[model samples]
Target: MTQPSSEKINDNTSFQAFVPAVSRWLAWQCEMISEVKIGTVFLRSNTANNNLKMFASWPENVSDSIEGKLYDLAQDVIDGKNNIMPKMTCDAGQGDMVYDTTTLPLHYNNKVVGAVIFLQSVRSEDQKKAVFQLFQWGCALLESTLTDMYEEQHKFHPLVTDLAKLALQDAPVALIGHQICNLLAQQLGCKRVVLGTMQGLQVHTLALSNQLRFDTRASHISEMEAVMEEALDQDQAILYPKSEEMFSSVTQKHQTLSADNEDASLLTIPFSNAENAIGAILLLRPRNNPFTKEEVKAVQYATQLLGSSFSLKLRDEYSFLNLLVQSFKKKTQPVFGTGHL
Candidate 1:
């Protein structure tokens, strides 16, 4: 079976796109069993909380009666009920076409999350047992898929949560930026991490991990700013020692920065708000310890949260400064005689 791609599973719509393929495979497997008439798969839709939607149905022309019955059986399985065995056969159509239904719940972390249902013609006891076993195996494959999807979606929750808590602290934006850099460096095992916020079209370095202060005009800092601008300009993540697949991304500044620093592996991810690019994060580590897809994704998520926090803090600072200016004007108006002094 072709497993769902990591990138697809991380997205709900893309994940659904692969369900039909899995259902097709399961339908083919069921066709091997002559007694099995129809196979349907139901999964909990992330878009609709707690609602189980029909992900795929084989033959594409199943009667409404059969589909409704299958949905009921699937719901039963998800509700922790006993497997609804073939207690009796019922007419699925107007004619004497009788069928028995069976459902198996798909589990992830030992909790029922979805189900697979099969409608089969009347068969002997042994035949029924074989069909049930096949359904069980199919459910196992689906369970494994669900587990992978769930893990991929949440693998960065801890990192994001930690960064969010730090960002929420009542501190200056620069101090918060420094704390974020320090946390990211420790979590991601980077030799250094730099945070920069976009000012007009240029990126100004805000904080560097493990350093209380540094000269902004330093050559190394300038190179780092250039690297961030390279990513912000392209509006995409850039990983230096660029992969063969990333030939289109302009990484000239990244290459220079990495070459100047012992050929270190460098990653720059730009974060933006609704308007435009707001900030970027640059991480550096040894060349041998290149960043992985998972690490890049985690940082991307973290940067999004950080960007919003920083924007809000900066806005607040601007508002406070305006209030202070107005207060000073009011205090000086009495002494200055309102523009005559």
Candidate 2:
């Protein structure tokens, strides 16, 4: 498959470490195309031999994964010689399927370092042009996400590593919640971080940082519960003090809490395993200690792993979870059993 072809670069990182989101981005590109999309591949050159190889492909095709010079035109584009992008249509898929493929060179420092190959059902040249444009948008997003991931890894802050270790540890959910609250409070300069778990439907305040005693029926606690539950119910991370977001029950509670606490800021991130939210974390900062966007984003990403772990333990805890629950009951008398919720 081929007739149309078309189309940056940055960074010095090896192409071997591809971004995980690129896979999703590929699938998304397949969806947005105005034609029947076949697949897309990012081809990179092997530095050792200067031979072209498939770096990654979407909708997985074994043929694309193979090491081969499919065409001289593609090789020419990769070699910084041919300026015309290659495009063609060919038979693909099992039982005689057909597809249109377009190869566009990706340049870096005026050198052709890689190429993007797009495939779909043979369509009008106009459709090919539209797809070419859409593909560019996908590439831009891919680049941004990869750069973000790279910067995050390069930073490698101690707190970030420690948070990762904490999330990955084998521990009871209650203990994990308590430790996470404490860790966030210390790392982010939060006055308090209340870890709340969605037991059945209602949210239960499982742990609070630094404090051993707090009123369960306190107005502030009620607001926290409301805000946390809202986040979990909606499965979103929210920043209080009303940014460019809508007014929900959680937002309203946050506004009330802010007024009472001298406009203290709040950041609530729901803990979900991609299926459903199991809990949430509410970070409370004093007036002068507002949470930054970077800090909020870092905590939100950290919760992705932590939330999955929590959900896994919540649903599949055989002995450890059961023992933990029993122990909690024996010790603190179960602050609101899921049954009570």
TM-scores of the models, in the given order? 0.55, 0.51
CA RMSD per model (angstroms)? 19.0, 14.5
* Local distance difference test, each candidate: 0.73, 0.63
lDDT of 1 by residue, 138-246 (tens): 4554555455554453222467657756765668889988999999899888999999998988999999999969999998998899999999999888988887645
Candidate 2 structure quality by residue, lDDT tens digits, 1-341? 12112211244335566535556656655554435345544445433234555555655664532224334545766666655434443445544545566666654333455666665667565445444544554454455444445445332345544665565456666676778889999988888899887878988887799875678788777778988887776767878865564334357766776777778888888876555677888998997777776787678767765665565555546556688877877666467664653
Candidate 1, lDDT over the whole model = 0.73
Angstrom error at residue 8, model 2:
9.5
Task: Identify the leading candidate in terms of lDDT.
Answer: 1
